[model samples]
Target: MKQGLIILGVLILGLSSCRKDPEDPLHKTPSSYKPTLVDPATIFPVGKFGMPQLPSDNPFTEEGIYLGRMLFYDPILSFDSSISCGSCHKQEYAFAEPKKFSTGIFGLQTGRNSSSLYNLAYSRKFFWDARQSTLREQVFEPIQAHNEMAMTLPFLAKRLARTDRYIEYFDKAFGSNPNVFDMSKALEQFLMTLVSKDSRFNGFFPGKFSLLSDTEKRGALLFNGLVDFDMVTGLATGTDCFHCHGGALAQQNNPDMGGIANNGLDGNFTDKGYGAITGNPADRGLFKTPSLLNIAVTGPYMHDGRFATLDEVIDHYSDNVNYLSPTISPMMAAHGNKQLKLTPQQKADLKAFLLTMTDSAFLTNPAYSNPFKK
Candidate 1:
């Protein structure tokens, strides 16, 4: 009987040895995915961009991301526990607020629109007003803001510390201790993994997904200037859409000629974007021009979320240069009297092209979803 039991145990051990480990494929590592050239028809390659500066103290970890996601969707961060980050930034709308600006937990509306969290790993600035520099710092803004979450960090930390659920999560994520409830670091790990590089626009990014529709191909020609000037502009004299919205990312912000343009906002408006942060006259009315990837879903456009639709945004630029702001971008002024006057058919084509920027894979990815589900 003892010999038979020993033989059975040996057989079980051997079977288990042959099975693949789930955690082996995805382990805790500091290294990023290597950039690979791919056929655009097959797989979308990750977009090339500057690596966002991460804090050395709070390194990225699966446990931390998992915890951050719970905190992000949980209303416990709010004073009334009625609102969360997901409250404003809905996944259906590409993680952007549906309204012009999101109403906070207290029913007071925020001054600026909620920017989409898509590909936020690449962004240097956080808010439309450019208040927070890092994503870590940005997470704290809504928590303390009277209009947003309206919960004090220290008080909230205390609230979380008392909880058995959080205590286990925090200890697992960041070593077991009394100081493990630091919310900022935990939140940053989660935000870092919110990468969105799977867009159709990413097809052209590093030569991936080569197959594109004829209209989309033509639209790409117009966007990247593969087509002739008259054909692209419909006989307009000046301005190319890709000039300002440049690079693989579609939003240019280089060191020499950084592309944060004022975009000819009518001086009648009050929102002074970057100027609010630096207090520089040159930086007035200049906001960070975001990536066009998933642009279709993230609407109510512009810094203030003034234009509700893409057509309105395109129409505003079509021969209606309100060069009233002192800090209006020179590129806007250079558009001259005439605009990129596209025919009805061409406009439709452009809209279709914009739609191609949508990356459903990233939008619906389970990795970035709220891990704490009922």
Candidate 2:
């Protein structure tokens, strides 16, 4: 009986030794718990765009950006787990899809064209209708849109908490359990980092005539010149594009000028655009004017994606200004209700200048690409 009791005690001791001890509070955080903050100056063109007005609450961090990128490419954010934000906004097309309308959850169509995502940090307004005021709020719209992601916040929170990677990343990025608020801040951090300033248009400046071809030079002249008629050809030498799309950023960020305008796509409003949002009739037909940084690729232009090609777009401005539209842009109506009537050569030149805005680097930058893809 004595030997048996000793043996039992030895067994218990061995078993207890093999079992794990209680975890230390200091070991709770991973040894790699370091949130490297990203400098806004490194990503933003401070000298050119005057340092994009970033959200003070959500400063850029490497971990947060990576987390947001994973979320962007992850379809799990959607109701059916089918499409992600990246699905509508592809990196190859400067984060703006080539399709006329974006296909959302259950293959439903979005109301407007997928706006290109870049240089957005510089602009205060968002969406083609300028509905949202900030990127964090903007992301929630598509995620919950019945026709888009069709996701509910409660479900999204649960799904995010369910994922092990999100759990780890959420802790690493925000030192919190997977939650929707941090998710939005992470997304905002990533979206604002998408800066597009490497295009040829950004490099070309005064006395840089050699940088452009003769045709492009003429196009540049026409693009930047005032809306004055040649008197002989009854065509404008200058298209006066500066009124709306002017600036080193190739976009007017000011709300009064190029931030919003009605390009006379229609005299009557079918969508009522910003008007619907503000409940103001005067704001009807107005849409956010996106930067021309990647104009060549971000085609199917306008709020409705009406103009399929640049030629069609030019033709509308040159020959089809709808002055009869009650709320027509004062800048557009300033043309004396007459068309610019650009010549064939002039149109080609204008197109050439516009093509210079395409930044191939921005299109293929792996940083913005889908992290899931090999």
Candidate 3:
């Protein structure tokens, strides 16, 4: 009888040990936990353009987006945990840094201006030089760049593994034992959710012309090349801007539509732009044409961040264009040595038109804001 009682007690002890504790870090998922799968298309609808290109292997989920949002705002991804992806890409500035060049983790400045983060769902190429082919691949570049986050994938993975919250998030986001690929996918999912189609300019496309002021309306026409000013005849015609920055997204939709252009920023190919990536001389001085959305807030324009204001940008196109570059776009060449010669009123109108592209809702949306801050 004594032996049987001892055996029963031992059995009970073993069973209790096998039972997972509610607070155990490794077994954090509760019995009620269920994966919440979310369709990326539902959150980011296809507007005038077709569906956003998403990787089939890494479809979005509520859990994944949550994890990605945390990672994006967390300084843990940086070498010293002092800077985050959000450091440069602030939500209020349309996910663009206000500075001409964003300072990195170690106070090192980036080579190019930080581009805005909206409407990336329509983009096939990433970055000013169009070097990265996909969004997921692009996420890793800034994290590993010496002047940026400067953290290795292996180190990041190990550091994340030590945190119980991160481990739980990883498990919920990418099943057990999440790796760097999982982290990148989560970041990509969050970024894909940043859609900016509700701008005032969007109203004009839907026949709501009243949304724009008179000055802005004229500017819109000039920007889309609906009205141009002939240099020699002093007559108004198309500005010829739609050739590079057109479509519903107000940026090049594909490579065939001149995704990158020399833009006549410089007479000499000092930075070499896309030519440096492809090692082709003809591609020199060629840089990707960024979207005009939120141009009012995303100041210090151009690849090198030379123009500090929209007025300066307009002045460059109006009176000063570098035609000496070998790879200057044919559309720009059509203008020849003659400038657009926009009048003062015309320039102001154009600036007003660009301001209408600002999506007030996107700039203040809590979802895109830093999660760490109260």
Candidate 4:
């Protein structure tokens, strides 16, 4: 009876050794992990005009956005752990840096100003030059650029793989091991969720036109070109600004409206703008017409961050635009070297209208804030 009892005790011990413990991390199965699903449409609803289409290959999910948000704020992705993507694209300044040019991890400065990042999901082209066509492609440039994050995919992958937490996130996000492709996709998903459509300007559509003050209303009319003046009769009215910056997004909504233009920033074409990319002289001095949304916050305006104030920007179109540039946009050519000739009051009103575009909710939203902060 003693021998049988000892044998029974040994059998119990053997079973305990063979059985997988629920508490053990290594024994965890992928099947046990359920990814948090998310509907992109619910997150990003269709606007009055239309919403940007999500890529069919890379659908958004809650887990994926969380992983992307983590990666975005993490300096771990940088080669020297000095800067992350958030370093240049800050949330406060509408995801734009206060400095004219963004300084890199090694203290090198990028040539162009950092563009504001809100409403990028609606953008078909990216960068000041519009060199990158997709957000996924656009994200890699900064990561690998010498003046940017300066981290290679292989290095980043290896670094992330070493972290158990990152490994778990990658597995949940991609249903597999971490890779550069999935990492980029995760970032794209998070960026897509950065929809900024809750400004006072949006209220104008819902019969809340009274949201804008009297001066701002005048500015809005001028901005939309609703008030047209008789040129010969000297009866003045419109600013004709709707050509380039129109639609609820305050950007060109159609391809026929033209994507990039020479806004007459300079006569000599110092930077060559989009010309260098397509190797077309006609494209010289032409750059993407950035959205006017949050224009108040995103200054040091223009591609080169040359204009420090909206007044200066208003002044450029008002009186200083160079119309004779060979690559001048047709929209600018329509003015025929004649300046906007806005009065000081009109300029003040225009500036006031622009301020209405500022989406305060977007700037302070906790969802978009740095997740690393305790």
For each candidate, what TM-score against the reference? Answer: 0.80, 0.90, 0.88, 0.88
At residue 190, candidate 3 shows an lDDT of 88
Candidate-wise lDDT, in order: 0.69, 0.87, 0.82, 0.82
1-374, model 3: which lDDT tens digit per residue?
Answer: 99999999999999999998754333545334555888766777466455877778877888888888999999999999999999999888899987899999879999999988987767888999999988889999999999999999989988888878777887877764546787888898888888887788765764466778899888777877743466697955557677787776778866656789878878787798888999998888888899888888997899888999889999998878876657887778767556777888888888898888888998998888888799
Candidate 3 vs. true structure, TM-score: 0.88
Candidate with top TM-score is 2
Candidate 4, 90-190: lDDT as tens digits: 89888998888989888999999999997778888888888988888888999999888899988887888788878888778777566778888899988
Candidate 2, clashing residue pairs? none
The C-alpha RMSD of each candidate to the native structure, in angstroms, is: 13.6, 8.9, 7.4, 9.0
Q: How far is candidate 1 from the true structure (C-alpha RMSD, Å)?
A: 13.6
Residue pairs of candidate 3 with colliding backbone atoms: 225-239, 227-237, 228-237, 228-238
What count of clashes does model 1 give? 6
Which structure among the candidates has the greatest lDDT? 2
Q: Please state the error at residue 284 of candidate 1 in Å.
A: 1.9
